[model samples]
Target: MSNVLNTFLDENLQDLRTQGLYNEIDPVEGANGPIIQVAGKQLINLSSNNYLGLATNDELKKIAQNTIETYGVGAGAVRTINGTLDLHVKLEQTLAKFKGTEAAISYQSGFNCNMAAISAVMDKNDAILSDALNHASIIDGCRLSKAKIIPFAHADMDDLRAKAKQATESGLYNKVMVITDGVFSMDGDIAKLPEIVEIAKEFDLITYVDDAHGSGVTGKGAGTVKHFGLQNEIDFQIGTLSKAIGVVGGYVAGKKNLIDWLKVRSRPFLFSTALPPGDVAAITRAVEIIMESTELHDKLWDNGDYLKKGLIELGFNIGDSETPITPCIIGDEKLTQQFSKRLIEEGVYAKSIVFPTVPKGTGRVRNMPTAAHTKEMLDDALAIYAKVGRELGVIQ
Candidate 1:
């Protein structure tokens, strides 16, 4: 590599190290679930998005093994050609029913779905009205669309409405669309979909909801769109087979026409290899488990409430999180990174979100409480939080 490139990389890495923001990769030696082993230390994991704890479920694993035995490991090529396995078809069908949509299309990953779906339908003449706090995937997708992106405030329907009105009234764009994360992952806040839908209707804007964190965690596993009862109204319902679904890949659920169009135009779908058979089977089984009962969903909520209440009682600043994603709001970025490192050392693994992820001073340590956590596990984690909070002067 050239000295210029090496120098740039070294400087960036140095900057991160000097600020304690350089993240050292910790490999999970064993399966990742409610708890995981890192460097032989078993830590209570509070940073995974496996809200329903389906990732380690015995049923999901068995289904995956069985499917691998029957169908082998890979999908071989892009699905539009010859890579579409029977398992892939099954997974898509199951997802449509699970999401309460007419049809669906699966991609290599949730991020791929965003990249594919956004660019597939919209073009440069179109404008994307995005939530300022939408996920990175959505932002990347908007960029890929080659469309002018206008950002609205996080979950502020009034702002979204104003932006929608302004864009529609501008008469500059051939089309206008509104895209948001159904569940804002950072703040643990739910989007005001009902209001956004109403605004979209008023302006005739295309609606897209990436329910990556919402699926298998909300509406008893249906998702945020279904949570708000606006299934059919949302033009694109994007979701992931990772996270709560206990598998890999992503999907776009909506009317048949949208999916049909995506099949032809989405570059990721047309150019990328499809989801493997085992993953597809695993996700299909996950959907069955969610549809079978709400036991995991209830357990997830119970654990979330317990952890949130415990953290609050300790007087640590947990931001206004409405879901299982609990954030200990540490304003200073350096201190936030230190707090996360200290938590890991204390056998509680969590991540620090710093500038460029959230805001400059609004740094936080976000926790994801899964259905697999017990009260004792949660209590032990909370005790560690209290100890760390007091030691760091984060709480009295």
Candidate 2:
């Protein structure tokens, strides 16, 4: 390795450590669920994205095991080659039904879905109006498209409308797309999809929604588009099988033409190997479960409410959150990281988010309450929270 490259890496890593921006990953010893084990200690985990607790579901596991037994583990080659498994086809079909779209195309991950689909449709001649609080993957996708990205205020319909009008009237591009997250992961706010759709129609803009955190949690588990009854109005609905679905993959559900185009034009699908048979089977089973009932969905919201109420009663400022995602805001970055570290020591595993992730000084310890958590577990976790909040001078 060159000395210059080594120095650059070493300097940046040292800076991250000194500034408290370096993330230390803790590995889970077993299956991820309502509770998890880390560093030989059991914790009431609030850091996982397993919103519905489906990641370790018995039924899903059995299906996956059976699939692995029958089909082997891997999908051999890329989708464009011999890797388009019958299971993959079924998974896409089931996802389409769950999303209430004409068709769907699958990708290796949610990040890949955005990276592949955005550039496949838009290019340098197009412009994209993105929400300021949009996910990093969406930002990366817009950049990959080589489109002129214009960021509007987070969920501000008026701002979006003005930008849409300006971008279209300028006659600067062949196409314009408006993109946002259905549910903002950090603040847990739901996007104004109905208003966005109305604005899109007025300006003839292509609407894209990355419903990663919304799927299997909102819209009776159909996501934000279906939550607002605008499934057909939105041009693109992107989702993840990893988050609420509790599996591993991503998808884009939309009109048949869009699906067909993505299938052919998306580089990841054409290049990367397809999802393993077991994962595909597991995802198919998971989507079917989400479609068949709302028991888990209701329980998830119940747990969320219970946790939020407990935290509020204890005087913790969990900012304005419309979903189960709760952020325990700690103003200073160093204090925020300390709070999270203290929580882990106290047997809760919520993580901290600070600068470069959220705006400076808005550091927070984010919590994700899931369906599998019992009232007893939440009660215990809340007791720990009160202890830590007082210890850190974050509460009375």
TM-score of 1: 0.98
Q: Cα miss at 357, model 1 (Å)? A: 1.5
Weakest ten-residue segment in model 2 by summed lDDT: 16-25
lDDT of each: 0.90, 0.94
Candidate 1 Cα errors over 4 Å, as ranges: none
Candidate 2 on 1-396: residue-level lDDT in tens? Answer: 999999999999999777777778899999998889999999999988999888999999999999999999999999988999899999989998998899999899999999999999999999999999999999999999999999999989999999999999998999999999999999999999989989999999999999999999999888989999998899999999999999998999999999999889999889999999999999998998989999999999999999999999999998989999999999888889899999999999999998788987899999999998999999999999999999999999
Predicted model with the maximum lDDT: 2
- What is the C-alpha local distance difference test score of candidate 1? 0.90
Candidate 1's displacement at residue 292, Å, is 1.3
